[model samples]
Target: MHPIAKSVPLRLLVLLSMLLAGCLAESEPVEVAGKCGPRDLTPECCLKQNPGQWEQCTGSTEMVETAKTAHSVATRVVAAGVTATVALQPRINSAEHRGAELAVDLLLRVDKAIAQCVRRAEREVNDYHFDGRSPSRELCQQLKVGEQTTWAAYLGLFKHEQAWPCLRKALDELLPKKNYLLHPRFRHDGQTGKWEFLDEQAVKKIVSEQGWKGLTGSIEPDIVILDEKGFIVHVYDLKFPCPETNVATWTRYKNETWKDWSQGDLYKTALGVTPKLVSPREGVVPETK
Candidate 1:
């Protein structure tokens, strides 16, 4: 090789090394679930900090792998456009796999939460020997004094109370793992019957500072799954029907903006994805028109 040509590769290697070093130096320690580790350590640094203890590291392995993959793509970009695309193939595939895994995990968590809440409700009713009557006062001293006289009366309350919080608990745990948004906030446009997603912090700040308000009250979706590009891929709502046997259905909005529009219709129109109903008894069911 010519002297200059040989030196080019050596210089490129040094530049790449310097860039990698700079990245490592700039890496901030990742905090997960209130646990913090040594500052300025990447996942790779964590692995090196404690050999074979990567599982215990605070830095996410997924993040480090993505960073490495991105670096590979950057390096290959100078070689050939096709080479860069080829290098990015794995990352694309990985993202798809991650999304699939997230979907399954999310559904499983929802199912578990539903089962647990339903089981508790059932146990409470059985223990109290509920007579399925609307109680004004405690029928027996055994029954705790409440607005609802019998434990059976409380089942209706359970349907509402357990649905959000139970799913919230499950979804919150999964939020840090993937691109799942719990109770994603959106601004509603009544004139067009469209929803403008409020995901950007800057937009939210602008809204708050400017006192910007939606034409209609905001639509809070139960769960939203975003793709690698941050486009919403799926939407889900938890529905716990009081009877468990009764089919879950979306309620029509009585508000002036939504008028008679069913929630399912609004969600579909706004999100471009069919909203799914997850019930304790039914598992997963498609919204019926």
Candidate 2:
């Protein structure tokens, strides 16, 4: 190798070593803005002092905040869009025009908020350093929740109205993972009336031909799991700020509220399986008999 080329590699190695040393030096304990007792450390301060606990605390906090912000922004955007669309109906006679107007209004209102949430979420995910790259799993999952929340809000607004079937396209975008009951499969046994898997194309065809009769209506679950026979194996209803801790609150969710809404029973009647409730905090509840 040429003399200059050999010297260049050595110089680069020394620079890299210096950069690593600087990072290590910067990791030393330092004061942060938050209040800290004489012997205590705030989470920010502890990041340098005790990185292990800091990782756990900060990771959990970030996840919780990311989920909350995503849900809140999604709810707000959808609600505003629905209200605006309703108000614009008299101004725009065509359904297409009203929907376009709603989309534009929502984009203007929430584009910045969504971008901020996405950036924060991406940063948190980058902190994990999985394989030296930020994993998309967490970010995508959060975004999916946001998408589902938006769709649910639209469903609520359009339910029992003429625009329902048009909005049902949102559900089609949220098909569950493969091997899960909700994912569309291609096989069915006609004789035993058991399906090896639910056919996505067939279901779409039915919806197109017959309307939203057997598929979905005003009352719907967050996720619908279908059996091989195209019957519902399980329905998942996601609840925000889950009612897990408070006994009285949980009682209302189980007895008075859900019972009156009959969402579970409605799914059962339509797809032959009772729905299960899910939450970010509590996860899936045990299936009720």
Candidate 3:
């Protein structure tokens, strides 16, 4: 009886330990939920069910595969825009073809510009999902700057008959909400310097709602971006663009044999233009600050 009493506590303690272990084994691991609006990322359930990502995932194969058709059109528009810029650069000074050149060049530039702008806009829209806000002015300005740079080389190069139409088409494709039903999609990758890919569904919606505005192709986008605190920024003054060199320069030590310069000869010419931003006050032109 004495032994039995003493053993009771020890046995009970062991039994309690076993019970606690069993309880822990039966319990599920915790999962903190993440969301994309009403949609949920639903932890391991979603991760396992979705395959890779909807873009590469196996379960939602149709959604991932839907984008294949749009790639060609996107690439073509980008290529055409770049070609127009290079061709227009030297022709700006030609007298015989001046009018036609400028007109064609400007239209092409506008086309490319708007295309870039739309692509950027689409990217911004995609990011909106993650950012929990519409595209910020900061993002727009950076995007606008890149778009503007890509087409400004031909802004005044020639008069383009199709310029206005191209610009309008480009703007129409963006700005307006297509579905307005689905949460606006968005993503951003600083490494790729590209916003997010516009899903096929979204792209199709835009096209069905607004027809294509293929480039000739190049564009000129007006940019007026303010900093986080609402102050305007001077991207030009803030950045020193590395000048393009078509030739190389050489230097020699007093008594040493001269080594071939890989950077080809180039010379510093007079400061052609010191670009400054001016707030627009007189109609279309901005006053220098």
Q: What is the C-alpha lDDT of each candidate?
A: 0.44, 0.30, 0.23
lDDT of 1 by residue, 196-268 (tens): 6554453435445643332134565566766555566667765545445566677676656567877788777
- Model 1 misplacement above 4 A: 1-176, 190-194, 199-215
Each model's TM-score, in the order given? 0.44, 0.26, 0.21
TM-score of 2: 0.26
Instruction: Report the CA-based lDDT of candidate 2 relative to the real structure.
Output: 0.30
Could you tell me which residue pairs clash in candidate 1? none
Tens digit per residue, CA lDDT, model 3, 1-289: 3322222222222212222222111111111122222242322223334422434322444434543432332322222211111111111111222121114554344335544433333233233323423333343223111122111111111112112233335534532311111111222234873333233453344445643221101111122122223221211111101111111112211211112311011000011111222111111211132
- Candidate 3 lowest-lDDT run of ten: 262-271
Task: Please name the candidate that would achieve the greatest lDDT relative to the true structure.
Answer: 1
For candidate 1, the 10 contiguous residues with the lowest summed lDDT are: 24-33
lDDT of 1 at 289: 62
- Alpha-carbon runs more than 4 Å astray in model 2: 1-217, 242-259, 287-289
Clashes of each: 0, 3, 26
Tens digit per residue, CA lDDT, model 2, 19-100:
2222211111111122323344333333334433423434545433443443233322212112111111111112232111
In terms of lDDT, the poorest run of 10 residues in model 2 is 83-92
